[model samples]
Target: MMISSQKVKVDPRDAKLSMAHFYVAFTALALGGLAGLLQVLVRSGKVELPYGIGYYQVLTVHGVLLGLVLTTFFILGFQFAVISRTAGTLSNRARKTGWIGFWIMTIGTAMAAAMILLNEASVLFTFYAPLMAHPIFYTGLTLVVVGSWIAGGAMLTSYIRWRQHNPGKPSPLLSFMVVVNTLMWIVATIGVAATVLLQMLPWSLGLVDTIDVLISRTLFWYFGHPLVYFWLLPAYMCWYAIIPKIIGGKIFSDSLARMSFILFLLFSIPVGFHHQLMEPGIDPAWKFLQVILTFLVVIPSLMTAFSMFGTFEMYGRSQGATGLFGWLKKLPWGDARFVVPFIGMVAFIPAGAGGMVNASHQLNQVVHNTIWVTGHFHLTLATAVILTFFGISYWLVPHLTGRILTKKMNRLAIIQALTWAVGMTFMSGAMHAAGLLGAPRRSSFSTYGESAQAIEWIPYQIAQAVGGTILFIGIILVLYIFINLAFYAPKGEQEFPVGEVTDNAERTPMVFENWKLWIGITVVLILFAYTIPFIDMIQNAPPGSKGYKLW
Candidate 1:
């Protein structure tokens, strides 16, 4: 049987704070969605804009605003709500720190966005070395990073204080998972922090004559792959700890769920070098090792899939259904909260398969810089991550605002999710097909002087443009639903759904909460994977290259 919690009234101040973060996140979604629409149009060679807005500029905006700003703000907001509701109210000082972090992030985003808009920082979101952006751009992003650190610090401090008061008890599952994600972020960001503060910022400011490309890229991938996990873990938290409850079931195994999260913390970072399989200057042996580690990280995902399917089977059987796949038919298909994220999980199946292909050294060569890679990540990040975020928003906004989510709004949300799925199916499918034909990514035009191979890609490019337009409309609909829910809906208290463990025969072991042990192992694994390769790169490095403005 499913266990349910009594509705707890959120503190007014905390609700408002979470709402503030959501506002910024949704605003980023709107702006970034527009940029995404324009990008596909321009790349298709079928549209032009006034005011000299180049492809790279729009691309940078799309990546930074959607990839970085939207995800960070949303995660922070969601975690704050989860922590506050589950672990009790934060101290006044902690709340103030959160507000401070918000402002810092906002100011930093504005600074970087201004530079990109002025065409001063057309370097894409990766901002790889030797193609430098303005110093302010790097500085602004630093502030954003630091702001996130401050926010995470506040959350972590609250958890520590809670643990001190409630010794010998398991922390609330949602809060525990939130802290895990925060700690993972703390560990993963060190590489990018080192790269930006020491290398990119200095070089952009002319404090350094040049910067090493290989070293910079290595540092980025060190952080980059974990960044995907950072985006993913929150969604996983919902799936494992909350979604089952929404679907009339409990999580299959709390102990196994905790173990899966712990495994993610241990395996996520050291495997990032898999992104560098095609890059030169990195040792192939090191790359192969990371590839093995990459496959290891997939274990947690498989664990999650197993737990989720088990939960579904139990629920279905409880409802008197029987058969190999009868549980699938018993799920709550009409509930927008369940359906939106359910579709995201379905999309992740293929996305995860694509990741394995990308990690393979031989397979990586075929799709390394191609649109296939673009399609792969679009399915993962855009469809899987973003769709789950939308699902969360549907309920989260209502919960924070004390609004009753009407049936009409829920229906609209379902429509939005379906629209997004349809659009992505068209766009990503075409991207993969065109990429197999040697169509390049990150280009304004792929015609290559209208060569035959390039000519074959045009239809797919046009299809991508059409798909993007549809996806933009879906995003706009989501934003609209959020605004109405937050500002205009009738006031009511919404319960936070925290799933119970189906297995009562066993308790979560104390070792699952031993974060220090996991963190130590994580650091050691990172060192083992990276230490030798980094030493080799720096010791045998060529002279660094000067910055350029090729666009």
Candidate 2:
């Protein structure tokens, strides 16, 4: 007897389920944003949440939910959009699995967030031992990460299967980036899974006497650093693939896009110790090596920035606009896709670049565990990533729903993007100042004490508080626009405008498929991995020595 097999085709434009997926991601993001608001407010003493747990729990939940869960779902949906067209019969299953993963991940993250907010598990989000939380929180988070892992699996399988059937045709640049992202996810999470399932879980269950705080942190950051790239890649992919089209130009160099993706895959993981710059027991040499790779990775990132911006210049010229960046005005500012990425770039450059400075071994000591660090991350991840997701949704959902947004709503989105960008900048600036003034992070309020004025963090704290209010208003506006788009936009009148399709879909041949790209990526990762044992050396050294081992 023979079994019958059938092929199924899913419409990429069938965004009804896509919209549901995005909403789940969006709602989680909004909750995280709310948590951020509360954190800032509570830290500034503007209001007390009355939770028994310290503010660190609130900050951790906000970071994990928004940065990890929301981003994972958003990336999953975005990846589907990029790959579905070329994925043949398996696209339907991929899309279905994507939505399933979204729901599971959202529910898990929500459960974890509720636990955090309810003051049940206040242990900070790190993998360090002796600071355990309620099992429910860890279990919820485990499910959330597991859901993302499944989504990554679906993406890899679908892309690989597509390539197998098609033969000799290279994967799309966007699809290749997704593959790299999936690879990084698998590699990074090994530590998290080992710690959570083997160490943390066992410890929480009283099966272990003590957990190795040093090894756990090492593993967590091993996951944490590259995990950042995972959040940023979709935005960067848009920067590479979608931005050029938005500007009505071909990408400056397709090779550059691929190069950047591969670089992220290789170097992104090894830089985890940069987060441990202030920690004990890590080898100085390994930290130094990571610092070097961290700096090296910046080159590809800057290449992306230049190429994407170059397209913007070309776009302006195409529109008959003149002068440097003058053509920005020629583009439709009301389009959320365009507006969000623009804001993302403007916020990312300074914040992300400054992050490299902090990533340096010595400089990290200066700003270690400071508010400045928080400000820097908020700039790239919170401000940039969230905006990109909103922008992509604006372009995608209308096409999916077959609805045209009201002209007013479009303009409001632009306003929302602008407001968010500006608000984040203001707050982030204050945080930098506060950090310099010795205002440490993970605290409910500035502990500058009676000499607060002397410490000079008070003024900056005031600025952060005010900036938080502005950010909250801007976020509310954004949520309102999306809600209206989903619920209020009349189904009959809603249609994605025509010109926008051709605006970004036209692609030139990608040049990054050759051996050169692989070699470059391999070299970077090899260099990164070579430095790992060095960190262990530092952990074994005597006190005050360069390689002192402190766990």
Candidate 3:
């Protein structure tokens, strides 16, 4: 059975809250997309800021708005809508909690963004310690995290209410996925929250003379790696449960989907050390252990890939298609809803491969801190995740707004997705090639005093500028689509696609809902992975350094 509130439409009140989030998310996309374009132009040495704007400043705006603010708002808003659709309308208390969380997050967003624009903070997305910002910047981001926690609490309350009402019956698949992602986010954030509240805030405010740099970075990565998964799982939600419906297919296995999510919640946190492999003070023994755990994550990723392929092939066969590759021809190539996310699905192949290379100690040494790393994340988050998000908006925004996606708009969306894919190919592809030739990531344009190797990177940088221009066009199309869908599309009901599991699929086990078991095992794994390394980092640490205001 498909999970639903048994309503033909999302409650208007619930949708109001969701639309509030969309307004902010698209706004962030516009500003951040422009910042990104400027960045590439600067790097290509084709343009310079006329009024003394710093490259790092633009970089911070791009990272914080797109990476932090936009993703969070969209995921939370989308999750809230799903919970309402699948479980039931959120109760008054839950709705209020969601509203409060949104405002707090919005206010914090302004604070942090203000600081970045004023050049008060340029620490980049990592916010590594010893590169301190004003206290309000940290405080603002803290509020963002706190607001998200409150929003997550709203989700938990809804999930718990569903379990209480439904008894032994299985939870809705969409609802269940939302719960898992929220739980994972809360767990993953503890590391970053601790670093900010206990470490960065104090040191920045003069409560501490010097900060422990190694510990700060370790704590951040503890949150950082899973943070990547946090961005991804929503895209996975669309792939697992939603995309099957979009392509006119049944979900391959409900139990398999739940199991993979459980596995992800377990494996995602303990493996942050893979990101820290290049840093000093970590033991090789522990790094090796974490690397092994990191590989365990690949199992769930493969499971997702298998499920997708199975869904596609089975649907094609049912449509009277034959032979090994006929399924490819059966898919809805003209439908933006399918093709856009399908593009994301294809991008993840290289994205996932690059991730594995980065996880290896020997291979990481080659690409670590290089533009290749930048290229890798751009494919994962920028191409794979963001494209999937745009695909969701094609139906979701219309469904919520009581509008139909005009055919013209649909064709435009397809063009938008292709433009983004092509742009990323040029930009990220150049980044990888240049990085292999020893080009660095995160630095602004320079001739490096005309060194031979530095000169090797210029052509690639120009390619990136060209790609950036194309991507900017893609962003504009998406924004125009959003505006039309929200206010100007012909008024009509649009269906929100939700996949039904195959009749032959095994029943979803109640064990998947044993919160005590899953959360307990997750805690155990995190403790086992980090306790020793953290103790080692602290006990024999070298003298700390005072904060730097490099920006």
Candidate 4:
């Protein structure tokens, strides 16, 4: 049995820690959202960057601040708060550790942002090699990664302490999900951490004249694809555990949710090769193997889809809804908390389709390196993950701030979400259409020597600018709502919704809590997938390439 509460507030101290993370996250959202708008304008050929700013510079800022900074900070903060709600309040030591981690990350973000501002690190989000940035940029990012690890320690400490205190009972669902994501994050980040610390850092500092490009890229995608899941699982947590509660439904199946998370841990890391399907140096056999693993990762996502639909349908039918689609009408459509994330859920259907296209070798060739990939990323992360984050924030921000989400703000949030939906449909749809016509990603306003195909892309680019502008408006609305909630909203008890498992659902097995078993398999799977190919790339590599400062 779970603790049943409609108005459990996170301890005030814990709330402060989580709010600190949110402040940074929203600041990143403001800056990164601005960078994103500018990028679209430049790409559309509507406006040139006025300050001698390179397109890649803005691109890096947008990707790093939004993709890395915003996601990491928000997820950590949300996790801490949720864990405090479910497991218990954090210990004095853990809370202190969280503050320290927050400061380190903030300082690191400042360092990295300063470098990007100075045009010292314009090597976009992937930071793929032969395109080196300042050493300090790498160092700053390293600290950021380290800071996250320390923060994760605080959450993990609480979870472990909970288990120690209560023998043989199932852990809280949200806490369990957080543990799974945090562990996966730790495992997946090792690849990037290795490349950065051992390879990129040494080369960037001029200690090495050349870096092995293949291995560096290999390491990146190794960290890269699972990074997708690292972002997605938190949203999934909301979908699986939190959303059900929000909509007045029990979780469809506690065991099913746990299983999907475990499957993600096992399969997400080995599938990085799908991202590298277009790159050479790896054998076709290994690429094929990893693509197969990529499909395996899809299973969990589908399971989550199945689970979410079931949760909603069950709740609907219980409320007297009938027919195949009646549940759609029964959900709380007016609640921004439900509607906003539901839009994200709908977007994933196509986003998942686009992913399948990207993962398949034959199909990937058509869209590889095209703006279609960019569109796919935006749909999945920017729309699906981000919109879900926004939905969570509506309740979460105020829930922490000791304030109620007023109806006026709730209506505004719904409008904000709709604006995002419309904007993304235009922007991403145009990118996909243009990409199929051979519009390249990561390039700014090229006419390609007046080629016909190139000219065709210009219209789609303009559409993206239109869409980007709308999305920026959505950002502003969200920030406005955030500010009111944090400082001025009326004081009240706001619930932190955690779903109860359906009565018919079977008990969650304690085996899921056996970290040694799950983690051991995770390690084995990663080793099995990467060991041979990584060695092959390193052993039979081409001459290393020297760094370039093209920007």
List where candidate 2 sits over 4 angstroms from the true fold: 1-17, 51-54, 86-92, 321-329, 446-449, 453-455, 492-551
lDDT of 4 by residue, 1-551 (tens): 46559867799999999999999999999999999999999888769898698889999999999999999999999999989999999999999999999999999899999999999999999999888889889888888888988999999999999999999999998899999999999888888888899988898899988777778888899899989999999999999998998899999999999999999999999988888887777899999999999998789889999999999999999999988999888899999899999999999999999999999999999999999999999999999999999999999999999999999999999999999999999999999999898899888884363567767888999999999999999999999999999999999988888899999998799999999999999989889999999888767766435223211
Candidate 1, run of 10 with poorest lDDT:
542-551
- Model 2 steric clash total: 12
Which of the two candidates, 1 or 4, achieves a greater TM-score against the reference?
Answer: 4
Model 4 segments beyond 4 Å from truth?
A: 447-449, 544-551
Q: What does candidate 3 score on TM?
A: 0.98
Candidate 3 C-alpha lDDT tens digits along 215-324: 78888988988888889999999999899988888999999999999999999999988988877788999999999999899999999999999999999999999999
Clashes of each: 0, 12, 0, 0
User: Alpha-carbon error at 198 in model 1, in Å?
Assistant: 0.8
lDDT of 1: 0.87
**Candidate 4 local accuracy as lDDT?**
0.91
Candidate 4 all-Cα RMSD: 1.8
Angstrom error at residue 173, model 3: 0.4
lDDT of 2 at 372: 86
**In model 3, which residue pairs have backbone atoms overlapping below 3 Å?**
none
The Cα local distance difference test for each model comes to 0.87, 0.70, 0.91, 0.91
RMSD per prediction, one decimal?
Answer: 2.1, 5.6, 1.8, 1.8
